[model samples]
Target: MASPPPHALIIPYPAQGHVIPLMELAHAMVDRGFIVTFVNSEFNHARVVAAMSPSSSPGNNGVGGLDRIRLVAVPDGMEPGEDRNNLVRLTILMTEFMAPAVEELIHRSGEEDGEEKITCMVTDYNVGTWAVDVARRTGIRSAAVWPASAAVMATLLSFNKLIEDDIIDAEHGSAMGKETFKLSPEMPEMQSAHLAWNCVGDHDQQATLFKYLVKGVLAVDQCEFFICNSFHAAEPGAFSLFPKLLPIGPLLTGERGGDKAVGHLWQPEDAECISWLDAQPEPGSVVYVAFGSFTMFDRRQFQELALGLELCGRPFLWVVRPDIGYGKVHDYPDGFLDRVVGESGGTGRGKLVSWAPQQRVLAHPSVGCFVSHCGWNSTMEGVRNGVPFLAWPYFADQFVNQVYISDVWKVGLKAVKDEEAGVITKEHIADRVEVLMGDAGIRERVEELKKAAHESIQDGGSSHGNFDKFVEAMKQA
Candidate 1:
């Protein structure tokens, strides 16, 4: 008799950045003949369903295409009318509230008719530890997916060592007045301020994040294998620090080939931006700016970014999510948008939207540069498309990603932030955009990295080999 097809339960942290990649992984698994159950928070699950609902776009039919892939949701313990953006609340939900529901779901998977037995589980490194514990209890195989770059993961993994060396006080969330450190001799230099969890919020918040990191390290250590959403070619030094890590990514896009059903939390609105991009002067002539799903800006910073984009005198596409600018919906500074369009002598060269089809936008030939927040997903997209960056990192792993892009990869230039004022002014934004746009060497390097990214996922490539090995490991388990 033939064996049952492998069944895997996949979960991500309840964030857009985390959900997208895990969805891509599920797609790949389905292609490899695994039955997949993709889990999301109740709120985000609705958003994703809405985003993929019929009457949206081509090839988007609310998960109708992939018969083997199933999406499931569990309550995140968020009360009605509560602010879902609260980090403390989210952490509590992941560690405490969501555990029972997930475990119960696992139990039900076994009883569902026509489904294979739950043989394996895969989850995001930061958010899926609770699921890992459940998998262990049920005698199922499990792996932790590190959803960030290998470099970022390596830095987080070194937190314990940094504490022992007095480089950082993990208990008190203090960094011993030191501004810089390296994870290893071969690793790129990192700013203490750039540590993803360092000084993220108030003292209590910082301490909470610190404890989360400590717990994450321990949870990851317990996993059967650590799967990273990065390619070994990108960060060799960082990969060396974690020998057990399986680097099988640059999973920026999926094999489904532009299918909108691959779980976008936010639907792509205002797609006219694409036609506007096509009408630009030439290939690699327009600047593209997006600060990812979360980064918030104050009024001054918002004004600065708008005015600065106008001052650059370039054809540009900018995504300004509605919730940005402290969620107040601040008006643009008195015809700033008009001035940007009017400056190019009546052709309306600049376009702004609430959200963009990012992968498609970056892949556009007219897009020359990316002004980004350096969220790992955005970072990977920029690299995948060979678009050099004007880095404007706000918080979290963004600052570290900016270091890798600007200082290490040499394909991006950091936007000067007035750290004292807690903003990057108009002057700094304009200056950095001009500097980054003018660099032929950076553009060339970006093209090389883009080629490398594509190559890594091709047949016999490093990522391909690693992914094959990972699948075999899961089968053996």
Candidate 2:
């Protein structure tokens, strides 16, 4: 009989944005003849299975190659039905509560007979030092994966220096009066006001997040090899900082020549949106708008966004989930949907859904520009599809990503925010959308990045070679 394929266990932080790319990595491994087991928190495992179950929606089938890959779960030490969306709560749960359960799972898998013994582990960047220690104690080969941009990782890794220079407080809030600081001459410039954890919540919460990030960086320092879901050519300066870092990404679900197996926590509304795109009059004429799974906007911001898309008078597909505005209903401006979508549905001005098949939306030929919250996955998806963006960053690494997209990459434009209210108004959104849609130069740059992303994953390319090297190292270990 043939020797059993190498077994690997993949763990992702249990959030939608984090799970999506990590699932892409899992699929990539399975295609390479590895037996992959994907482990999620009990909460997310149910979410995934429920969202992908045949009964949920006809379109919501499981990930591609599902028969070959195993799905498993471990308790996250939360009371049943507790909210997993709170980042601070998740940090505490993963580090303080879930580590023992995860370690036990890792240990028990190795004790199993035959081909089921785990040969390696792929862990989320925030899984903490305990995971690395577990791998060492158990003798399993391991690597860390950062789902965000490499540039953001590079910045966070240098948080200690920022502390030493007094540019930011070590234990308290941001340093006074310094709006911007550069980590290094090569790193992209950063605004202190836009620091991932800055001003997110009250003082205690902000401090907790800062401490969590620092712990993650220290944990990353212990890992032998680190992987980022980004193309090498895209962020040269950022990649130069960490010698062990590997860049083999823009890791799209469809890139491996397999059927796209998107891991959506919420089921997409359906093929109606795709059909709508097909009916658009011109190629690259439709605008695609999605702000990712997180990010809650206030009532005023929501109204402004609705009016802005209508004001632009472009054919568009917008995904607006009910959960987008805290625990409140998403109340769009009065008569907004009516004005945009006529009764006949023949005018084809706009189509809206609670959720979207984003990769599919970006891949469509009618998609000219993207209005986005600039989540890392969305940024890469836009790049993969050659779609330029009108960046409307919400928070966290999104602000950092906006700098790269608009300033460094020059493939997108950042939306201007109102000075006092701190929201991007209808007028500002309309103007930026017009600028993005009309600019041939922006379109050309995005196409170039798209080609570069595609090329990196081809035979003998940088990403391909790096992935080959990674697999070999695992086998040899």
Question: Each candidate's TM vs. the true structure?
Answer: 0.93, 0.93
In the range 1-477, model 2's lDDT, one tens digit per residue, is: 966677887888888888888888988887887878888888887777665634334343335325546777787777786766677777777766667776777777746555477878888887745667667777888888998888888767878777777778888546556778887678778887677777366667778888877887777676666888898878888888865679888888422233334566766446578888888879998889898888788888888888898998888888878663532433767777578866554354978777777888899999989999999999999998999999988877899999999998899999888998778888888888898989999999999999999999899778888888887676654
lDDT value for model 1: 0.79
Badly placed stretches (over 4 Å) of model 1 are: 53-68, 253-255, 259-261, 324-330, 341-347, 419-422
Give the Å shift of residue 28 in candidate 1: 0.8
Worst 10 residues of 2 by lDDT: 253-262
lDDT agreement with native, every candidate: 0.79, 0.78
lDDT (0-100) at residue 426 of candidate 1?
Answer: 77
